[model samples]
Target: MKLGIVRCAQTEEVCPGSKDFQALREKTGVFAKVDDAIELVGFTTCGGCPGKKAVFRAKSLVAAGADTIAFASCITKGTPIGYPCPFAKRMIAAVEGNVEEGVEVLDYTHGW
Candidate 1:
């Protein structure tokens, strides 16, 4: 599977997403569901608060050959930051609603 990850823009400075990458490498977390080897096609951040550009980012990742997109733990589970995005649900919905058909939009990469 070709995977694209979207992390929290706010947490990029404090975290380098090592854990997310580690999970991907080990097939832990959301990656465990993938039956084949995963290729990281894209890694980007939602464009700041409210995530108004999340849909566009997700679309861009899909256009870049990503068949599946996962919102990272920083955005959903809060990870190193300990503060989940307030607009996470809406951003996920908007991206899911906007992406092409058959594109899988997952809620998170490594946590609930």
Candidate 2:
């Protein structure tokens, strides 16, 4: 599975996404469910709070060869900030609508 990661722009400054990358490398977290060989198709942000550009970014990632769009833990689990995105559900729905059917959307990259 080719994966695209969307992180939180605010978290980007404080976190390096080490846990997310580690989970992908070790097949932990959501990666454990991926039976196929995973590829790092893309890694980017949600365009800050409210995630205004997530839909476009998702489309871009899919176009760039990602079969799956994985929201980074910083967006879902919140991680170091301890506060998940308030717009996560709506943003996810928007992305799901923008992507083609069968393109998997994961709620998180790594949860910790």
How does candidate 1 score on lDDT?
Answer: 0.91
For all predicted structures, in order, the TM-scores are 0.96, 0.96
lDDT of 1 by residue, 1-112 (tens): 8989999999999999999999899998988878799999999999999899899999999999999999999998888878989999999999999999999998888863
For residue 85, give model 2's deviation from the true position in Å: 0.6
After the best TM-score superposition of candidate 2, give how far the Cα of residue 91 lies from its true spot, in angstroms: 0.6
Residue 41: error of model 1 in Å? 0.5
